[model samples]
Target: MVIRDTHSLQLVWSSRISEDSTFGLRWTHSIHRSLVEEKYRIHDGQIILTEMSFHDYGIGMENELAPGEKLDIQDGQFHIRNMNRHFPALHLFIGQVRAGHTLLFSGTEIPLGSLHAPGAAITIQVEKRSILNEIGGY
Candidate 1:
């Protein structure tokens, strides 16, 4: 997986992800001031959104569950599961430092704020490259 600056097309971060590799993006809701998280997995070279959880249901939250989707509330948080949504790429706006935009992968936390300035647009996608090509930085 790779993350790039949308406007400049400059690579910000890159990592090798295999099939079934899971990761998550988390940030604070602007209006509700609560935590929101989206979990994803790599499948057949595609990004699949597997689950989403949020602390509040106010503006910007999904109002209703879609077919084959399940909604669960636990510990005061709403979790939507079985989404299985596919995306070629993910575009995100880097929120303010307080929003705490972060990437969770491989049991490590990578704050998006450390990679780009606040309000920057970034694109995350899966890219295929040969081992030699990757090592050569081609």
Candidate 2:
């Protein structure tokens, strides 16, 4: 098998959000580019990226995906909140998850996993602050 050379691109920034735009998370490096790759586990959170993936604006631009583009999940905003019952996932992002008013994360996938898995399983958790803490209440 030919191995692809993925540049060591650190996670410059990261964030999370819900379908209703309830809560979210953002990573700001004290030093620009302080992020690292293969260390996606944040706040003791780790998710295996499924073969799920999709381009931006999956609603209107659903047609953009080619015949074998290989899109596992979606924008995540609508997905994580209200799982696409239509398409169930096998891999998941296990973490402090929530639907709207909690501090938890559904199963999150890495870029690689998100690039392949068809479906995923997510676990939820409780949090004191709204997802707004990570993001600006959006």
Model 2 segments beyond 4 Å from truth?
1-21, 29-124, 127-138
lDDT of 2 by residue, 14-46 (tens): 345222222222221222322111111222222
Model 1: residue 131 alpha-carbon error in angstroms: 3.0
Q: What is the TM-score (0 to 1) of candidate 2?
A: 0.14
> What's each prediction's clash count?
0, 29
Displacement of the residue 103 alpha carbon in candidate 1, Å: 0.5
Worst window of 10 by summed lDDT in candidate 2: 33-42
Q: How accurate is candidate 1 locally (lDDT)?
A: 0.90
Cα lDDT, all candidates: 0.90, 0.26
The digit string of per-residue lDDT tens for model 1 on 29-123 reads 88899999999999887899999999989799988877899999999899999998899999998987568899998999999989888889999
